[model samples]
Target: MKRILTIVLLTISITVSAQTLRKYSNEFMNIGVDAAALGMANAVTAYSNDVNSGYWNPAGLVNLEDNQLALMHSSYFANIANYDYLAFAMPLDNRSAVGISLIRFAVDDILNTTQLIDAEGNINYDRISLFSTADYGVTFSYARKLPIPGFNYGINAKVIRRVIGKFASSWGFGLDAAIQFETRNEWKIGLMARDITTTFNAWAIDKDEFATVQNAVENQNQELPESTELTIPKLQFGVAKKFIYRHDFSILTELDLNIRFEQNNDIISTSIASINPAFGFEVGYIDMIYLRGGVGNFQNELQIDNSEKIGFQPSIGVGFKYSGIQVDYAFTDIGDQSVALYSNVFSLKLDFSIFR
Candidate 1:
């Protein structure tokens, strides 16, 4: 069963040429990192002020008060795939900060069935082998407070790596830019530009491995795939405000607009661009315990009757903080509103100052 599934996946991948520009290249990077953000349906652009900012909006890294480390893990597709993240951030003087983050998503133990049948037409289960497909991303971020008070800017340089067993691999690079501003009234605004320079991935396929599959299945995969994948720029704008009551209880509300250059099934779609809006809020008591909820991923879905229906994803989460250590958990979908099962995400953050 595993062998059959692997072959089907491989064949589908082989059908795409390298020259074609894919609309959803490097999609693994978009899965998000922190549980707090995921629980809020990824609406954290304006107030992500911690180690995870390296992946959200780097400009928020400037708000880090102490050296911090973060880790996260989540499973998807009924545990067939695993996603993990790690990050560290530190303040450089009082006005500048730097951070590094690493992310990985992988599916392991896929059976390679190209050699399941022997050359003499004999069935041989021993010839089957296992392999894995994985994607990795590493990002370095730097943020600084602008000369103007309450203003900050940041930049990120990212490297992307992907491998499908020993059959194919790719290396890609990209950049991100972001800015944040706070008003005297305590309203926060942020903008993030992903793939600001247009990321590119150069794929290299192992012809020998590919040939084995080609010989196994006739009239398919006859041509080698030589491809460079391109990812166009995307923008996210967000605004947030925090309301405090009784000096001990607070509520933070945030709204984000995710914009893509091409038209799609987003709520607001046009020839020039598409916009998907997300809204989230967090209720906190004494800054130690919190509850969060959000709605996002708005799309127009075609029902069985060929009628368009608006669909959205809703998520909820909880968080706890004590002595500079924070733990968060979220129950949410993996950005696909069609998926019936939601994923459980957990993350931990530690501030170095706790030891001091």
Candidate 2:
């Protein structure tokens, strides 16, 4: 059984190529959490004020005036994958705040091949199995207003776990830091460092489990061994401003720059790459409803092949607020229309202070 599982997982891992200069493992962490942010092409680093801040820019948590909770769910990768996020934040004091967040990405109902064949090499419907591949993360965040009036600083400590249908698993640890500054003229600037300590994922595979399907494992030429994947540091810088037309209307615009560094095989030379530049815009009506649109993921080539071509991923979203409850919806084109790669995300947020 373990052998069969190993082969399946190995086959999946083999699909990834070192085709991009910005190569980092566990890319799932890069996925945006709430519909509000995704709708804005992930340009919310400077303007994040909701529970989603726990994931985007922890410094924004200081903007929370009351205890709040947020939940999000999205059908991704043409409905083949599911992503879910949850977060809660509360003010620790006038100048400080704390938050907790959880994320889970999963693909389920995968066929269990080990049980698919009968003893005589014949297929038996009863001998079937199903499993899932998932990634999970939990984060704790702290934010405090700085002595510099409109400035704030924050940090996030997180643990990550990945599992491959009882075949392989990994544990990782990382830290993130952020700072935000609000200018007198409605402009906001934010800087964030992700995995500053260099996150590491230590993977473990159960070889003993493979004994059940020894022949299958032997043919794959895979020597089961413990290994680790490292994710280097990344930086994000953003600026946002709101143009208020009237007491009842305003437009918010934002831009974000993502910089990543990678080391060469010799470990002597390092290179920096700008992974993507994101842009977002939102229009609000009396603070009750919002319309958003944005584009991101600018690159010369979409993939390894030069002919693939690259184009911005565009997204649109709508949000409404009633009392202490807010609801948001987003429609995103995940690129490559031929593969049916679009997605929809929905999120709900609640402010407990309304009850008080």
Candidate 3:
């Protein structure tokens, strides 16, 4: 299983290099950051506030009431991969905010069997080694209120780094733009454009390391892979409304539309683009305890009988807040709906005002 997994990873890396515009390039970044957002099926674009906004919708950062920090961790594929996140944000003034976020997703300690066989065809288990493939992302965000009341805009400068043991590495850069608005009636709307300038990643492969891969399979991977990868722009639009009852209990519902330029299995597909809709709601009591649920990732799957079936993922979570500290937990399928195993996600938030 380990050998197969290693080969699969190498194959995916090479395949990505061969394509200039990959539909899912740098997808680790899209796995999301906060458990609360994930529990909502990533429908928090308009409702996001606090430090987690740095990843969801930077424009929401303008709502920060004080300096805040956030941390999150989740494991995928039955602990075969780990994802981690950290973020800090502060209100620069009454109408502006700034934030920084970091994320990492990695698969570690995979056995490297390419060197197990000697040139003379002698198999030596002692030659086996281990390596890891990891991807890192850093984002700097800024948001400011517009001259128009209830209007705000934000921008993100993102850096991406990916490494496959000592075999290959890449560096990438991208930009994002976002806006949020609130209506007089208390409706919130948000729009986020990711990779607005078209992210680019340039790869560097070590020939010495790649030579082993080339020889592993005859008539396969004999040539060097391409070195450039591109990520096209995507857009997410969201609207949310909160209903308060008797000033103590509240419910917030959100709907989001995710648009991609390429056609895929999305529920709404067209030659120009595809749209996937997500819906989530949160019930809160005195802003201290919360329950959340959502559904998303609509896709049409081909069944064994050559029939197509529509499927979606469902998620639920709970949150607690008190004295400037917050903790959230979510139970969800990180993969597609077909995945039977659900991953547990946890996140923590701290408000600096607590120390003051």
Best by lDDT: 1
**How much does candidate 1 score in TM-score?**
0.96
On TM-score, the candidate that comes out on top is 1
Instruction: Tell me how far the alpha carbon of residue 285 in candidate 1 is from the true structure, in angstroms, after superposition.
Output: 0.9
- Model 2: how large is the Cα RMSD against the reference? 4.5
Q: Residue 253 error for model 2, in Å?
A: 0.5
TM-score of each: 0.96, 0.89, 0.94
Q: List the candidates ranked by TM-score, beginning with the highest.
A: 1, 3, 2
Per-residue lDDT of candidate 1, residues 260-341 (tens digit): 9999999999999999999999999999999999999899888999999999998899999999999999999645675546
For residues 7-57, write the lDDT of model 3, one tens digit per residue. Answer: 666766665654655546788888888888888988999989889998989
Candidate 2 clash pair list:
2-209, 3-210
Could you give candidate 2's per-residue lDDT for residues 225-342 as a string of tens digits?
A: 6677778898889999999886899899999987777533221224655456789999999989999999876654436653644456788999999899999999887455223378
Model 2 TM-score?
0.89
Tell me each candidate's RMSD, in Å, in order.
1.7, 4.5, 2.0
**Model 3 lDDT, residue 29, Cα:** 84
Model 1 residue 214 CA deviation in Å: 1.2
Residue 125 Cα positional deviation in candidate 1, in Å, after optimal superposition: 2.1
List candidate 1 stretches off by more than 4 Å. Answer: 14-19, 334-337
lDDT of each: 0.90, 0.81, 0.89
Kindly give the stretch of ten consecutive residues in candidate 2 with the minimal lDDT sum: 14-23
Name model 3 segments beyond 4 Å from true. Answer: 1-12, 334-336, 339-341
User: Which of the predicted structures, 1 or 3, would earn the higher lDDT when compared with the native?
Assistant: 1
